[model samples]
Target: MRTVRYSNREELEGINSRPFLANHLRTEVAVHLHSNAEPSHNARGARVIVQPGRPADARLAQSVLCSMKELIHSVSVYADFTVAPAPHTGNKGENREAKMPSIIVETAFHTNPDDARALQDPVFRTASMKGVEKGYRLFSEGKDCVPLKAEPIDGIHLSAGGSQQVDVAFEGNPQYPIELVTTNVGCPPGWTCTDGRVRIETPDTKPSQLTLRCENAGSAPMFWNTQVVDDDGVKSPPVRHWVQCIRGPGGAVASPGVPAGVEAATAG
Candidate 1:
């Protein structure tokens, strides 16, 4: 849910630090998304890589893979799930180093023309992300559960060290008495989020709403994740809400145009 990097240009934090930070933040499941490639340019499919010999990691991988396979044009889903060893030597990175379950999702092969075109389409990109969300829900909750839905609040403009109370509405007429909580995904360094309870004045007659407070101490654009949890412990898919901060002095928005680090911050 929370992204390690907001832009492609971000490189201040190296790969070795990702797993360490994820562990420090105590993330539930770490998912690294990437596009695949091959020399033959004939290979095509969505693949998930997990740490070797970890059942929990494999379970997470399969759950995500099952949902993603339905929406993507993959020749193979890699049902078995690929188990990857530690990257290089001294310090393990990403999947291998995380304390929690982790997986790498190779959505498609850019090397293949058909897959490359699909990845470029906006419709396809949206659908693919939906699959990942559903897959995550399946893992967190269960297959038979009705996944909760909330639209993402992205690209909010705020001042550095400023706070905002965001009102998020549920997608459908969900049942009452659901609690909203921050997901395992984390916030950027120096940021803080205070979660709120869901309130519905009219029950099923209208959508439920949750008003949460977010404070950004740094001048950067970042996102955090939250999900709806029912009384039975079933969780809805995670929703990533983003905020862009402006410089306090000049009131100029800090652009995500340059590389920067987005480490974990406080959340409740």
Candidate 2:
């Protein structure tokens, strides 16, 4: 069981390199993990994709999705919590021209509040990976699953060239070396306002707080990906909290824009 990373910085930078490296290494199968989204923010649940006319790819896709189906829980009011009826067919740059079987797993929709909350839970991360392991013990598995909840922060409006202290709080028996990251989505094009990564110095299991700085150089929104990582290197699912950076005058950097409904602390 080998792991492959297509890009760093939580952004899609080296996508085409996936199939290239897989073919170069002569890997037997390829699996891509991803979260889904849509403009409506109503879509939820997990699904898989494969290249058309490939039997091996189809089987691998089904095998993994079946396992994920059992582990992930749906938050959709419409009862859409299972994998798609069949593997979706596509010729994406990451899957096309691969000499071996390949499949892409859409874990869940980050656009939905319930699904997004589940994605950040450590228990959900562990269980989802276990499902993938079972799927692979047999190709891999998907996440609206949660055992830990990170308080949600949104509607955070900031001014260009202004900075704010973001306090991220969550509930769980967290292990040491927790890592908070920012995903590729949400930030404006060519903007580098995200803090990128921050480490929790304390190892408290309850009422933990992670404070970091987020400065805006452009007018756009940002989503911070928060996760708990044990010393063993296992990572919890990411909790993506949103912030809005605005470009205008009269906005103060020191005046915090802490939104309502979130339990957060301000760094003095």
Candidate 3:
């Protein structure tokens, strides 16, 4: 299933369902993506769909559940094979016929408002992708889950005519090299965002920094969105930071020591 779903096809059968999923069992670990619905429209969070007796698939589900839980606290994972008719199983032909480990990721419920909102958010979507990718990596590569984090800054009240420094450090496991891409978010004109720049890429090393210059005259808040992009082109969610800039008249700057409520959050 390369896309979300095929509307032209029937529920239980489809003409494009060729090449046979069982034929690719040795080469591909089938992972189906789906969204749920309920009459109450209150079902929320995430759920995992996996057939019983598959230990590796269960592990994959758990990893995804845990990683996503870091962003969405209520996310859940469970084995679902409770179907109808004579089978009475929780899974279907996609995973049931495969010889290798397979799972279905119920990302979120479409019926719920909160889940729908989260589904539309780029940040949340990226996090879910990272969780799924990391889940597979944990099961297949046995690699460590790279803890991607960035520092927040505040009190960037700089002088109206002088330039102020803006630096952010990206830290995580060095084994998994990452490239942090930062872009300006709602930065005003004449108020140079890192000197009229938009995108900055972090070096492929641990504790990399994005050095920016808050130059020119401005009296507005500055926001930036940074994403951790891996070598494989997979990006973690987004880590956002904002600094209230008030270019005072006397050309004097205040050293923003420790932000008020600044905390680090993981990027996709």
Prediction RMSDs, each to the true structure: 21.4, 18.9, 12.5
Model 3 / residue 189 / CA error / Å? 36
What is the lDDT of every predicted structure here? Answer: 0.56, 0.58, 0.52
Per-residue alpha-carbon lDDT of candidate 1 for residues 1-268, written as tens digits (9 for 90 to 100)? 8856557334524664787888999987788888889998878767777777787777777767655644342222322322221221122257777888877777778898877886787756665666677677777874522335666755477765344455555553233466666542444554453333443334453443433332344466555576765433334567886666665543222222111232223433
Query: TM-score: which is higher, 1 or 3?
Result: 3
C-alpha lDDT (0 to 100) for residue 245 of candidate 1: 63
Which regions in candidate 3 have their CA more than 4 angstroms from the true location?
Answer: 1-9, 14-19, 71-89, 143-268
TM-score of each model, paired residue for residue:
0.43, 0.44, 0.46
Which runs of model 2 end up more than 4 angstroms from their true locations? 1-13, 73-80, 139-268
The alpha-carbon deviation from the true structure for residue 77 of candidate 2, after best TM-score superposition, in angstroms, is 14
User: Model 3, clash count?
Assistant: 10
Output the better candidate (2/3) by TM-score: 3
Q: Summing lDDT over every window of 10 consecutive residues in candidate 1, give the lowest-scoring window.
A: 82-91
What is the alpha-carbon lDDT for the whole of candidate 1? 0.56
Which candidate number maximizes lDDT? 2
Screening candidate 2 with a backbone cut-off below 3 angstroms (N, C-alpha, C), the clashing residue pairs are 120-238
TM-score of 2: 0.44
- RMSD versus native structure for model 2: 18.9
Residues 1-268 of candidate 2 have per-residue lDDT tens digits of 8988754534444666888899999987878888888888778777788888888788777766655654443222323455675688887766776789888887778998877876787766655665555565454222222234466644456554444565666654333566555443454555443244456656653444443333433455666666655433444567766667676543222222233233222222
